[model samples]
Target: MIYISDKAKQKVDALRAEGTLASDYFLRVSVVGGGCSGLSYKLDFDNETKPKDQVFEDKGIKVVTDLKSFLYLCNTTLEFSEGINGKGFYFNNPNAARTCACGDSFAV
Candidate 1:
């Protein structure tokens, strides 16, 4: 299962309210190759649900992932951080064996 922090949910809801995303859209999380640590994380808003997709709901927000990606992202946590440096979403993935220096990629 995936968890979405309250901050993350609030951000998503605000984005939707501003018409930045469709009402039917949900968060999509995936792991891909080619990052500094050999694996990278991909996050986006999506409306399509594939046959092998796994759906998770938290605080009324829906998060989706394909079977292959889900294997690498199970038990992951989605969060939002705001600071003088910047404000953005963050992922805490338990399945990651190693993470890149930038913290935007990982390997398992």
Candidate 2:
């Protein structure tokens, strides 16, 4: 099961509270190729679900992902940081062997 940190949940809640995102929207996470570290993470607010999509909920947030992405994201935790390093979402992925300097890509 994928997890979400409290900081991440708070950010998601703030986004929804701002009235920009629709009520039915859910967080969709995916892994795509061609990053500096060989794989990149994608995130979006989606209201549609495809066949065979995997669903999970954590910290009052519903997260969806495709089966193919699940293998690379297993036991991953979604996190948010506002430190001097960078301010954005990040993944604490146990399966990742290495991540890039930008923190937007990883290799397993």
Candidate 3:
């Protein structure tokens, strides 16, 4: 299962209230081929649930991923950072053997 960190939850809340995203919209996290690493993470707000989709929630934030992506994301945590260096969502993935410096790509 995937988890969401407190900081990420706050950012998601703020994003939901900003615009475009409605109550039904949820965080969609997926992994795709090609990056500095072998795989890259993709995140967005989505309202639709596809067949065999895996859904998980943490801190009132709902996250969805397709079955294929779920294999690479199990036991992962989604976090957000707002430090002087940078501000963005991060994937703390236990399944990843290697990850890019930006933390956006990984290889398992």
Candidate 4:
């Protein structure tokens, strides 16, 4: 299961409250090929589900990922940072052997 950090939950709440997405929208996370690292993470708000989707909920937020991505993302935590050094959502993934400097991509 993928976990959501407190800061990441807060950020997700703020984004939802901004009224750009539908009320039923959920966070969709996927790993796609191509990046400085071999795999890149993609995140977006979605209301639909695919046949092989895996779902989890933490901190009142629901996150979904496809079957293939789940293999690479299992046991990961989604975190958010707003410090001067960097600011955005990142993953604390135990399965990753290496992550890109930007923290958006990783290789197992």
Task: Report, for every candidate in turn, its global Cα lDDT versus the true structure.
Answer: 0.88, 0.93, 0.91, 0.91
Candidate 1 has what TM-score? 0.93
How does candidate 1 score on lDDT? 0.88
For candidate 4, report its TM-score: 0.94
TM-score of candidate 2 relative to the true fold: 0.95
Model 1 segments beyond 4 Å from truth? none
Off by over 4 Å in 2: none
Per-residue CA lDDT of candidate 1, range 17-98, in tens? Answer: 9998988999999878887898788899899998888999999999999898888888999988777864499888899888
**Top of the candidates by TM-score:** 2
> Model 3, range 9-61, lDDT digits (tens) per residue?
98888987897578999999999999999899999889999989999988898
lDDT of 2 at 29: 97
Q: What's the count of clashing pairs in each model shown?
A: 0, 0, 0, 0
Query: Which of candidates 1 and 4 is the stronger one according to lDDT?
Result: 4
* lDDT tens per residue, model 2, 1-108: 889999999989999999988889999999999789999999899999999899999977999999999999989999999878755999999999999988889999
**Cα-based TM-score, every candidate:** 0.93, 0.95, 0.94, 0.94
| Full-model lDDT, candidate 4 | 0.91
lDDT of 1 at 87: 40
Worst 10 residues of 4 by lDDT: 14-23
